[model samples]
Target: MLPIRECVEQTSGYIPGEQPRTNDFIKLNTNENPYPPPLEIFEGLQQELTKVRLYPDPVSTQLRKAAAKVFGVSSVNILAGNGSDDILNIAVRTFVNPGETVTFLDLTYSLYETIARVHGASVIKIPTDNRFAINQPIICPKAKLIFIASPNPPVGKHLNRDYLEETCERATGIVLIDEAYADFSDENHLDFLNKYDNVIISRTMSKSYSIAGMRVGFGIASIPIIEQMNKVKDSYNLDRIAQLLGTNAFNFQEYFKVIWQKVRQTRSHLIESLKALDFLVFDSDSNFVFASSQWIPASELYKKLKERKILVRYFENPRIKDYVRISVGTDQEIARLLEVINEIKSGQEFT
Candidate 1:
């Protein structure tokens, strides 16, 4: 066997949420939209089938143009990727030198640190203010790149805008905002791209457009930054079928808006329902709820829920060990999950 680098050998890989490939589980561990995307996406697949024999456009041109029309930015300012994770990897490679520091909020996105490690860059894992209602900016003065999840993960709350404004004014390095869940949130940091040349706002069609299977994400940045990142990506990063589906989904904002509003309404109901059960539910700005309780241990609930074939995310990281993150599923799915919880409370035993 070939020898591996010490960093790669010792590092723990990023673990995505469980994906059981069966219909039996009420799956909500991953933050995916429960609604189907617009009908055009499926209809376009038949036409896209004809062009599979050829290579995809090295750079996704038409898709970027459609994205430009939707984002109200020039095509030059947008850079498409296989997924936002690809953009994160490209950002680290583009901005951070081999030994330079890449900083991000700890507990926000585990993949950020994993990608930094892959690039052989040093990582500075900063803490959220208080874990739950935490809001703070990256303070690593020497960092070459900073990735901020606007509506942070696990906790599912928006960052304090004042800190972001200060970051734009104070930070000397690149600022990348992960807006993967922003479509579900009422807040966004897109305006920062115009105000700061160092800022890059990344968006994904996975959650909002219900196209996670397509793997298309794009970044909003200063033209020069996008251009540099463009030079770092694979020639054919996004496939032809992805380009067609992504473009159609990007253009059909009305469909997304309707589905998103439904999810938001369901989110409010789920939060209240959980709170009424005496769980400590955090105020969510994203499409999931972060809740814990002194009465029932999250781990036990997670195990019991899994046994019953209902899946919600449980992070083993000590900081949030007591909390479980539940994705916003369809109204019927959420209702079923709540019913199971009531059953668990009534008689099911917990460790």
Candidate 2:
């Protein structure tokens, strides 16, 4: 057998949401923006296509400047990455030494566990109550890195700011708040950066800017933390086209705000519809909702939806086995989903 690190060999890597081969289905599985990005992004990309032959700006300088201007921070306070996933990986590599501990909410982005394990770091899961609220103190005295997702996935429940601030004050580690879905949420933790030197707020353009295909993201932190993470990241992490498009995306924030509002509106409708079907839906601050059903096994519901060519996320983990995560789609897409769900509810086969 080919040689591999023992930790890598033992790990079961992260499984992303499914992507169908055909466009025939209405997709609500991955939490991607259903709307197209502003025309400026494409227009900028067309001009930058010629530069693909050259190496990208290694530090993504212009992109950072654009983001800094919009976020009211200096470029030195931001670090650009291929995606927020890269930023997370960089943090894990730079801060957490091998065999050191990393911690996060139990049901958060599973990638946190996978990343730590792959890097040979021990993981501590902070337990949450039935409502997905942290029941234990999030401060892990021994942990060197802590990842917390606001408007966290699977449940889309935002963590309490008081608890988060307390964790920042008390923990001995770097607290990285994964705000990938913050654009859809009620509040963000960027302000935490000013108050806490240990805090890092990572953002992605995938969901709000409708640029998942471009893989653009940023890590906002104290200048020192940003500098260290930059060292660990891949040289030229953001490609030429990605940098051009990502920088252009910041120029159209007003247009993007319109898209965010639309997603929120559709999310309200999706929640109400799920409730009508007897699903216990969580109050979501993200672009997706976590819903549990007493009438049918989530596995059965997932299978039936796939049979009808409507895709959503269903985790087999025992804690969330009764639930499915549905992404907020376009109004027309959501209407079709609700109609199909009604049909599935009446069929009685899943029950």
Candidate 3:
């Protein structure tokens, strides 16, 4: 019998949200932005395709420089990846030894646990409070690396700035703050890099930037940390098209602003509507809302939505079993969802 590693044998890998091939459904299950990339991004990719015969710049220097300007960091301090997920894998490979521990929030992104397991590292899941506040104290002191997702997944609650600072101060291991949704939020911890050598902040172009299919994400950290991650990352992790498209997206900042404003507006309106329906909605700084319905179980609601060609995320885990995470779609799409909820409520008898 071919022998598999114990970690590989014991762990079930990360399962991404369903992407139904059918075009009829409104896809709100994955936290994808409901906008298209600016015209410039498409043009940039088209022009760059002429050069695809040659290998892309292995270092992705142009993209890194553009990202540096936007992030207010030196180019040396930024490292681009195929997506933020790639950077997470690279960080684990670079920092975590086989028997060491990697820690992240208990109910946060499910991918981190799988990444840790794949790297043959122990995982410590620190449970969040009822309000989805990360309990930083529970992280093992001897952990080799920690990954924290702000505006955490399934709940959409952010870690306070002070709490993040305290975590960095107390942790002996490297702390990676995954700020994939930072653009939707009012604040970010990028400045923490200047103060903490052990801190790294990862961002993605997938959410607020409306370029999920483009596969561009990056990390901002001290030069040394970036250097180590670079060593572990694949030489051609980012293709020429992604580099060109991402750089062009950064160039057209006004285009991003317009789309982001629309997303936030839709988010606010949806939150109000959900509240009107008597659902408990968490305060979100991301492109999605985490909500629980008193009248219906989340599983039942998810099925109902699916039947109507609308898809939202529902986790079976205890912490999030009662909730459904709904992504903010275009105004018409959201209105349609609200209408369905009202119909469901009207038809059902009281418990």
Q: Candidate 2, residue 322: CA error in Å?
A: 0.6
Tens-place lDDT per residue, model 3, 1-351, is 112387888888888889998899988889899988877677756667788789999989999999999999999999899899998999999999887889888778889999888778888888788888865553469789989998788667678777788889888989999999878877788889989999989999998777888899998899899999989999899988888888888988888888888888999999999999989998788899999999899999999999999999988888789999999999989999999999888877653
Q: What Cα-based lDDT does every candidate model obtain?
A: 0.86, 0.90, 0.87
Using Cα atoms with residue i matched to residue i, what is each candidate's TM-score against the true structure? 0.96, 0.97, 0.96
Best by lDDT: 2
Query: Across residues 1-351, which tens digit of lDDT does each residue of candidate 2 receive?
Result: 222388888888999999999999889999999999877677766667877888989998999999999878999999999899999999999999888999988789999999998999988998888887885459789999999999886688788889899999998989999999988866988889889999999999999989899999999999899989988999889999888889989999889999998899999999988999899999999999999877788999999999999999999899999899999999999999999888978888555
Task: List residue ranges in candidate 2 displaced over 4 A.
Answer: 1-4, 349-351
Backbone clashes in candidate 1 total 0
Cα deviation of 243 in candidate 2 (Å)? 0.7
Which stretch of 10 consecutive residues in model 2 shows the poorest summed lDDT? 1-10
lDDT for model 2, please.
Answer: 0.90
Instruction: For candidate 1, list the clashing residue pairs, or say none.
Output: none
CA deviation > 4 Å runs, candidate 1: 1-4, 133-136, 348-351
